[model samples]
Target: MSQSASQVYGAVQALTQSSDTLFLLLGAIMVFLMHSGFAFLELGTVRKKNQVNALVKILADFGVSAVAYFFIGYQIAYGNNFFVGAETLAQGNGYELVKFFFLLTFAAAIPAIVSGGIAERARFYPILIATFFTVGFVYPLFEGMIWNNNYGVQTWLETHFGYGFHDFAGSVVVHGVGGWIALVAVKYLGMRKGRVRAGKHTNFAPSNIPFLALGAWILCVGWFGFNVMSAQAINGISGLVAINSLMAMVGGILVSLFAGKNDPGFIHNGPLAGLVAICAGSDIMHPIGALITGGIAGAIFVYLFTYLQNKTKIDDVLGVWPLHGVCGAWGGIAAGIFGQTSLGGLGGVSLVVQVGGTVLGIVIAVLGSIVVYGVIEKCSGLRLSEEDEFNGADLSIHKISAINED
Candidate 1:
């Protein structure tokens, strides 16, 4: 090759690489902000006594996820080889850094999701440990199967079914996993003090509305990066994903407002429902399809939240299951319907395949969470003592109190 030609090629390659790096970095930054949203939202929902604990857990989860992803979780999730040694590390070198950022956000999510359930009473140290195991190992394993291009479950699905289970962003992988974990954690932790007394129930109002609203807005903003950047390409498709995400949020807002008789709590959760619902097919769905999908998700969130809170005794402080798990399922299924090429090159696979994938993802998530939480509870004890529960984990466990001293 001529010297000038070689130089030009090298320069172009460098530019492309730099551009890709920049996009990934931006996506990482946005995903990081989601932790803040989760923190503020959770703090708003729980009583003041648990505020500090919630904040600390949110911060600590990010740190734990970072360390775990760097050491082994990244490799386990995306590496070409699974053998433990220098050879495995060498084979996994190039992808480690990118996987670290991607999986760290994912790991952070698991703890964030579970935090709501154990709000008000659980010990801090144990919760931290659970976060470590969840993000470090459990969450990564599922993510590996879902997104890892080389040897993931997606690959198996493609080989066996002739069409891979699609999750353009991570409805089934991220939110679904988090929701199941929250369910198990809540079940194991039992109910918050006074939640059930002599067969009667107690109502717990949000401690701060402004905080919740701000958190919801933050989540809505971060979702742009979550859905659009998942495409990993900065072109027309990315723009489409961004539009879908926005539309979905708007749809969620409208649906929740109308469906719930203008309930503020439902309104706050509606945007999340839209985001989660659209995640499965955000990359491919048309703008209008996204609206419908998001609206349905919002409605589902209202229904599930009410059912769980009023009909059942599940004390899901932040409604993670309804917002993430159920909506994630809706998103995945919506992809199968709206992804039809007629809509925007979305649905083509048989309905049975789509349903199977959704069912399989949920089953795996639920069972995995059950086992992980059960083991953690047995080993370290998941909840605080009765006295500590009354005193609040923030004070009893962390030695810091949110209460003002006279």
Candidate 2:
């Protein structure tokens, strides 16, 4: 080739790489904003007296997760770390740095999910410690197994079942793990004070519905980046992922509106439930299949949340188990079913592998949370004193409440 032709090719390659980097950077920012959604969602759900703690915990947990992932978790998951000089780190178009930012947002979400379940009573620093450990160690372990194909789990699955587990994004990996971990933490921390009495659950109405709705809206809008950007390259981006996400969102909304009896809280959370379920299959499932998957998730959340809170007295404040744990697991399995050619999907998934991978993820999450939270519980204690609980987490921990009158 002539020198002029070579120079032209170099320019085109540089432009493509730059565009991909920009695409992923935007994705990281969008997922980062979801942390605020987590905060405000808890802020609106918890009693006003505990609202400040909700905000503080989400922000603090993100800071801790960033530190942990930068130092250790990213390496565990992807065999890469920012240990070298900044000059060297910037060599790969800084794509690795942006990728870390994106996955770090996901790692931070574990504590954010647990925050809701253990809200109104958990000690702040202990939960932060849990955040550090979870992001640093627990989450990255399985993240490596699936996303990075570490330890040959995916390879083994593919060999045995003719396809590996197919979580295009992270339905089982992120939301499912976070939700199950939250369940264990909630159980260990015990119910919030006055939440249960004589086998009955008390109703604590959301303090600010508008804040709750705003948070849900933020998460809903940001989910496009979360799903679409998982493609991670300009050339790999897909209109199908975006459309599947939209269909699932509307399906969740419509179903939850019906299933939840028009409750505003449920209606807002419906889209989130759908998004969580569709994350695993967004790349492979048809839009109509995505709708069905999301509709089931919406109905599952409403019914199970009621049963867990009332009959089982689980006291999961935000219903993370139903919205994330179960629905996320369902999403993983649904990918195997709905991603089949027979189901009008892309057809490179297996039901057995999907079920196996989903269950493995939940098992790892449960064991990790139990060990981490159990140690924290025994050592520094996890819950507030009864007196402090009555005073509320905002006043007791942060020395302030959401509203005050002199």
Clash count for candidate 1 is 4
Candidate 1 residue lDDT tens string, 1-406: 9999999998987676556656766787898899899999988888888888888888987887777667767667777333456555443223334535755786678788778766887777777777777777777777777777535566667777777777888888888778877887888887788876778777689989888888888998998988877755344337778888999999999999999898777898899999998988887789899999999999999998888877677888888988888898888888888888877655545445566778877787778778777887888888889998887768887888876787
Models 1 onward score TM values of 0.92, 0.98
Per-residue error (Å), model 1, residue 88: 14
TM-score (C-alpha) between model 1 and the true structure: 0.92
Candidate 2 on 1-406: residue-level lDDT in tens?
A: 9999999999998888788889999999999998899988989888889999999999999999999988999999999977799998886688878888888888888888888889988988998999899889999999999999999998998888889888888999999999999999989888877777776677789999999998899999989989999999989999999999999999999999999999999999999999999999999999999999999999999999988878775889999989999999999999988999999999998898899999999999999989999999999999999999999998899898777787
Model 2 C-alpha lDDT versus the unseen true structure: 0.91
Deviation of model 2 at 129, angstroms:
0.5
